[model samples]
Target: MVKIKANYVLAALWITLLCSCQKRSPEIPEIRQVDVLIVGGGASGTMAAIQAARMGSSVLVAEETPWLGGMLTAAGVSAIDGNYKLQSGLWEEFRKNLYNHYGGPEGVKTGWVSNVLFEPEVGDSILKYMAGLEDGIELMLNSTLGHIEKTQKGWIADIAYQTDTIRVETQVVIDGTELGDVAALVGIPYEIGMDSRHLSNEKIAPETANDIVQDLTYVAILKDYGKGTDMTITKPEGYDPSPFYCTCAGRCNQDSIGRKLWDCEHMMGYGRLPGDKYMINWPIFGNDFYLNVIEMAPHERKQAYEQAKWYTMCYVYYLQDALGFRHLGIADDVFPTADGLPFIPYHRESRRIDGIVRFDLNDLARPFAQTNALYRTGVAVGDYPVDHHHAAYPQSEALPDLHFYPVPSYALPLGTLIPKSVSNFIVAEKSISVTNLVNGTTRLQPVCLLIGQAAGALAALAVDEGVSPADVPVRKVQQALLDSKAYILPYLDVSPTSSSFSAIQKTGATGILRGEGKNIGWENQTLFYPDSLVSKSALQTGLQDIAAGLVITSKKETLTVNEALKVIYDLMKLRPGDTHFSSREAMDEKAKEIWKNHMDTLMDPEVSITRAMFSVLLGELIDPFSNWPVDHHGTYRSGIN
Candidate 1:
């Protein structure tokens, strides 16, 4: 972690206060600064701050809202992605907290893909606790970013309030703001609306592209316990139930953003409270704050946002009165302010980075074996489909079904997180480079948190290693990820000495580093799809299937340690740039040394012969891979050992 000057820190926080002092309020607190200035305390921004602080750096978060945890907390939505499997680290911790409160693990049973429904308050407490642990993480809420400029030493973030303006000159500036507003303010190249071309060749992209973008939503909390309460809520300014809808509230369309508008389907939804003993997520007010509010000027945006809040409050009144329910309240305890107005105004599109590598929809559906190039630099796996949400269908339409293209859990490149012009800055939110269609799926809360963790980890690596983020070696990045228990590279639990890997040699190879939809049968059999589940059965089956596929030249009396080493060396050799061995010559050298050492140990009977010993050695010797290989045409091509 780099040491920041005290004066520079004061400049960053005060810069915002300074900007605010000119207009409305008179008295405001002085500003404070830290090493890294995060503009948004949403999902990604929070994760970035925590990661940086964990690595021993000074970090500060400037949130426009009072509370953190953007969508999960402020939005009052209980559902996470349908594909939040392989839960670990920050995400896993979030679940643990919910389970602690709910008294049982939530969600329908689906092996690892089980959904974890939680109350908004629990989510808020958990996220705040996660970042609040570090003394170095300073939170400056109700502060707004006014501008960002690159100085010789590093970068400075200008934040403002009604009475004061603060400037934070830090080594790194992360644009975790939901709208990617910070990136725009910093002069970063970004795409605003839908992509001009169907880069992903997605079925949902319009035949004729336009500047139209997806609408936002303002989710409200509701409850019903058969108690007594007044709940007749007033509708929005233009809301009409008789002719309800312009856009599909419950569904999504892939193509034609210009044809979409907010509908009534999702205007108010119901779900089980933490215990599944009550009702929740009944959006009776604020038809859609995140959607229409983007078109407003700053003050107008604030007004629209507040109006949505009031509308949502009125909606709760409507639901209770209409349904004749007794037990229901606004749940204002969650947001603390805005009268239970969600802490976040669900932002869909933000300033996406124009990086060296771009992931389009076409690449996702391509045969994993054919487009293996996509995995060469994979840092994380995404088994979800290209989820796209558009406007224009009511609750009666099949709008949510258009986004059915399943993509593999492929590697995300380090390059994609780095901004082109801003060297120290990284865009961890949906702001990372991708087509709008791709952004639709990736913008989910879970994805943002995980990607933010990865980005934060990389930023930590850069700071710790005294190198630019671009120069952090790939292998170092992978190791740091592994150390943090993040799953950028999938791991197989096998034992040559134990029963886990009955046939050690065959079970240890990686045909596709991808999970779920890794271009199934396009080259090899790597099953992948949106509805894919990561079950214990799948893990066992994949291990056996790939092991059986290995070509054994000769059947000897028994598999020796020497022979196993050769096989291990060859499997890792499919790609030259990987960790174990980069070249055939190097592989042979390491194999010789390993074989000799094993032979020497075997020659001595005093050496341990227990299965436990063999298993430990096998696990240690197994090649750990972070990504797969692709051929020239960018196909998921693999060569057998």
Candidate 2:
């Protein structure tokens, strides 16, 4: 009888243990639905989330690192590069915040390498503050994405955060991850490293394609502790000072009157940040390490990153031991890492997606002459020249001299952000579809921020309209960017603060009054010449492209107010078949009715119309961009006229 009771007790104990194990198996992670799920909260990803949230889309940003900014903060490249005169949208907002934090523009200009420089921590705090203001954004730091699949409605992804797995159902996905990891995870076709001349048709590209990416820098931020401080760290492994001997040797600057400013002080001041901090990211012979970790597994990448970190530590030791700058020590309070280095490396290249349109060097060299008017669909702009760091590679000698091909300031096309096959995917970071040559300019911080803003707008519009990102109207995206004080056209003279900013942007995108671009020194310029007079031929040519079957009877060389008004009347009557305006008299009366709506001054019929006035009149009245619909390639669709 006692043996029978023992058997029953053992059976009951087994049943209880089994039930407990089943209960603790981690209940399949509750589904969290969002309108947009942005992977990687880097520079572009952060801007994308904020922009999407502002557009009324519930956004979830999954970042692998704890900090928000990628290269700008987490990677410790806090010095701003390019787009100095072309501050638009979130870039401008971020800069203004820096100015406020540091007491103005002059305060942050402690470094000679860039006009804007700050500590990485400050940049992160500002970005976090900016993101916090938006209520729709759910930023998950130290989070990673896993197991994403496309569904008929949208996408479903599993996000791992703090020992918990959260399933996300998102309408649109933005690949803002460093090295384009999210796109790679989703099986998006992408190209890495150098492209052959035949592939890109770029004059500067090498004849043969190779998997040679730019050298990544493991940045170290050093602070001036005190005059007699001995903050020198122990010597790192492989501490040969031969590779760094030429680091202080100045580089040849073609823009600086062909002078090479060689000095140790100049090298130290290159990335000098505010508050007596130094950004040790010297590219020449410094800490730029060559490693393509894009395709590596997580553990493999972690191991490779350790080597890069050691290489940077060697450089830091060289500065202290050899150069005798012992007062400057690693900024311990900057990052949370144990080694006092950045959370990530400053990746200069990524997996360039095979997007709907592939931007090349030819597009930047000649924007208006392209077979497809890609410039018309521009969503982001960059002015930085084509810069590549290949000193570490032996094969770099076979490549063409990139500095020989000077490109003007250019805008990035909207199609470059949308993958050709992905339904609702958008690429925001350095991974956007561009030739290896063009990625040099687009990969900068300011351009990446603007690209992120554009990506957010595209994703939000796609979710709101229940359409794919490729199907969203090009002009609608541009309009949304302009509404947010961003630039679609790279007009150096006309800033976002101008009252006629939207007017000029709309007209410029329509290819009506084109801006002239110039590559003078490092500062590339595209001037609208708002004060210049609008010639009759230019006006007629622009009108013909949009308003088909319209006749202009103007004989004068330049267009006056009366002549411009006549052309507008003719275009109105031809297209949309405006029955409200029977003749020039009726059209003029209607124009007068809406004159106060667009202009601040009274009507002056005899005054010659300037380019600015003409753009304003046509952009407000005709609205050619609205009627002209464009495809993903920026080519006009048929049957629109």
Candidate 3:
């Protein structure tokens, strides 16, 4: 045999490997099916899964990371933003549970940046525990979406779990990922970076679309080192010292509004958390990544993430060696990484979908409630200011035009969650269709959580109704959310803690919703008596307290259905000879005309009324707005305006 030269042998091996790669077969993905499939396990994804599971649907939650909380835990942005007192539904439950965990609400206010604060690990554990209690939810950590295809049965998504691949079929799919990855992978039309001023009609938007987005930060947790401690951080390779612009205490040192004095400060910013730990998320001096992570290849994205961590490491080095804060060090137990840093970046923007309804600056300007029909369908509420973080990065020339302003407490419409062309899909969190200016406030943690909860509820309702998410009636979704004890309107004083809150919330448009209950003489004190079985006598008394004309002198224990109908007819001044009455055998043309113009229904003669019926009847009679009450056989039907 003739021996080949070393170079020739190496070249032959490389050619063989290339040919073998081209001939290899693609791997097959395993299949699994569920009623609802959620692609992210961040703040919104967790809430989406919980709500869907709560609605008797089998939910599959696939998270890329092991921990649950997104910005709050893995990203280490533990400071909760906006809607502190307006917490409703699952959010209220979360706050209550957090309070109980910390022993009281006072204990949760451990930091100055937010009214409520807790350790990142504490929040992560709480979310995990809550998900664990739901039997319908199957959570798969360390899994990521690979490829998604739409099907007649809804949709199927290929998920990658390290070396293994699984295909998931779902009736409803919610895109709650931090960066809107599901929407992008499924071919949904979406926008990345800043939108145009004319397109979104937002005053703060630029004239044209810019690839610049809000800067992301690799937040760090610093523990108090004893006095005179001398720990030093090594300088990271390829670090840019010119970008660092902040002193340690940026919060108190800088101006509160408009452009800040400097990017960094010398004092601890945003105050501290419990256990003597300080959160270092100051935008001025902190390590903020100005590059766009969306639409990046895997290797490019990984390199960007590494750059962010390296920048933060450089900042830590500055804090300890340069700033003379030798006493401060990275929290040893906060994160599992080698240097004890957070696992991910706190992302501020995502690939926003082209939704059925687009929220703009005008929607957040307070007058859109009456002018826009979609605005009336308020599903989530937020009150955060429009915050943009572009001044810190010099390379992001287009981002400096963004400015902050106070946004009114506004409701997000259900249309924002529904995509324009996609079926059986919903996008929550920062992915919802809104202008860049509106996203400033809507991207807050509280609003995102509510959106996630509503998305889940909407998905569950769609699955149950055998309809697409877009086909579900807005009012029905609102009613389902209301029934779930969600606070649609923030004007109400009573929360879910009130016994009759759900009933009162549902009847708000009918002008029958009341605050504290009126005192009935029989009761020990004034109360709604929501749970007590109501009798006819009690309803008559309630009617007297509400309607001035529907007074009944004879108080019977339980009046027959006929008596109730007769009482309502008498109050409306209708007589038996009227065409509405079955006794009108020889009604004249004029009498028939009167009955035709004012249609009403009559109830059964002998059945007793329930408490719900009594409340409805009482509400119709005492119309504060002086609107006509449509009578469906004396069944308290609300009249059309």
Candidate 4:
């Protein structure tokens, strides 16, 4: 009996040991389910996270760096580029915040290069504050992408932190990375460096594809030396000081204009930040690393990154050593890095995805009348010139043909964000499907933010509808963007001086044009009477002119609420029994009968109407799905699409 008891104890101890060993081994990664997973925490990533969270989705944002704003903050390029006057949506919100933070709008306009400029830290704080407003968004800072696998249900990404890994399963994934890393990892086809002219059909594209890409820069934020401070930086390993003194902006560069070295401006520019500091992103005779990091291997990329930093350091050293700017040192308090440089290089080129629509220079050069469909299909708007940086590089004879000018403010289509072969995925940042020439403009901070917001909205809508993001209709996406107050159309520039400017502004939100009145019956008299009290027939005709499809006409003094409801009912084809009017449903009640009676009372043609009432009615007629009864829910504008 004793021996048997001992044997049982020994067996129990062995079992306990085996269990301990199993527990010590690695366990399955924690599976976290989310509606959207946004990779890259730059300008687009932050915007995407906020937009998706606002749309009632659980979003997980994994950023490789600690900062949220990529190019705007972490990359040290704080000077906002493009979309200065056409700001709306989150872009407008951010700019407003910046303006308020610095006392007013003039605070941000401290530099000549851009309309808005601030310290990188200011942008970082604002983005963090914005991210905090969304409870559904989980921002994972200092997290890197370990691995990713696509499943039929969605995508699974392994997010590795210090000593643990979290597996994120999301229905939609947005590749907002600066380099399109996620797209490449997921086997999506993309183009690196410059594309051939024959393929992109960009007038500026090269005849053959080349490995040469735009130069990458390590932007420097320098404070004025007159602030009673003295500093010095260590000289870079490569001490070559010859190329740093040349005139590269074509103003004095003899290679272009046959001028002496002293003819060009210095390789520096005014900073947009406070305290009159200077932002040194100068590509002329400065640190523009000519290597193509996107096409490089792991080892090669690291080498290039290190060399770029060294070049920037060399430039800084020259400022103090050669140029006699002893007080102008690196802003130690700005960047968190030990060397006072940005966490990442300013990558001007990335592996652009082969999206459903590849926007080129033609998209920017052509007028909206010639491409109305394309204009109406735009999801974002910008008017930046096609400014290419390769022109400043060595052996860049092709640069002359590559640069373009007078690029008008144009809209970017939803198709530009959708990958041709991939579902449940979208791209933001420079990785968007734009030709190498067009990328110069589309890659701007404001445009990338718009793209990010659009991608986020599409992802959230897809998750809500249980459909792929690519399946969501473009017009529906446009509607959501419009509701978000994004400026989607740039063609109808309404001047405040016009009597119909306010009406045009409102109606243009729905893609309507303020029509020009024509002479009727050969009387040579136009009926567009601005500042006159509008009649019922005139209002209806104006609606029709704006293409609202309302045909009811009357010469009555006042338009009744019933007439508006009837027009809406006719245009939307909403029967008496739709969910839109389900609020009237009760126990044993005829909801359709109630709706018909209610609409009849609301549609009485004799009720007097005001201009504000007309505007509200027009808003409802254009978008029947909107919750129209709420106070101030009506969109102000001419009804148009």
**TM-score top scorer:** 2
Candidate that beats the other on TM-score, 1 or 4, i.e. the better one: 4
lDDT per residue as tens, model 3, 229-290 = 86566677876555554343343445543445532332464647766777878676567767
Which of 1 and 4 is the better model by lDDT? 4
| Per-residue lDDT of candidate 1, residues 127-146 (tens digit) | 76666666678776788887
Give each model's clash number: 70, 0, 17, 11
Reference-based TM-score of each model: 0.70, 0.92, 0.74, 0.75
Candidate 2 Cα errors over 4 Å, as ranges: 1-25, 250-261, 547-552, 577-582, 593-599, 638-641
Residue-level lDDT tens digits of model 4 in 1-641: 33433443354344224322312112667678999999998989899899889989999888877778899989988998776766567898898878767777887887767879988877787787777767798777777788898899889999875455778999999998989988888877888777788987766677788766788888887776674566658777868877676524433445664333432224344554786566778665777777677855656887778878888888878767776666788886788787788888888878888987777777556623233334445677766666677744678864545443546567777778878888889888889887888887788889888888988888888999888887776656766776787755543233233333333334433333222222222111112233233355555544442235557654455555555455545544433333333232221133223334434443334555444344444453334323211111112222222
* lDDT of model 3, residue 621: 38
The parts of candidate 4 lying over 4 Å away from their true place are 1-26, 225-229, 247-269, 297-299, 367-372, 491-641
Off by over 4 Å in 3: 1-29, 238-242, 248-266, 269-271, 367-370, 395-403, 507-641
Better of 1 and 2 by lDDT: 2
- Tell me the deviation in Å of residue 247 in model 2: 1.1
Would you list the C-alpha lDDT of every candidate in the order shown? 0.54, 0.84, 0.67, 0.67
Worst 10-residue lDDT window, candidate 4: 627-636
RMSD of each: 9.8, 10.1, 14.0, 13.0
lDDT, candidate 2, 1-641, per-residue tens: 33433443354344224322312124578578999999998999999999999999999888898778899999999999999999799999999988877778998999988999998987887787788778798777787888899999889999887667789999999998889988888889999999999978886688899889988999999999988999999988668888777676443343442324358777799999988999998876789988999999988999999988998999999889888899999998889888889999999999999999999999888987778789899999989888887766656566666652567888899999999988989998999999999988999999999999999999999989999998888888998999999999899999888878888888888887788889998888899988899887776676655665666676778888888887776666656543345677866665666566657567778878888877777766667676667766667665453
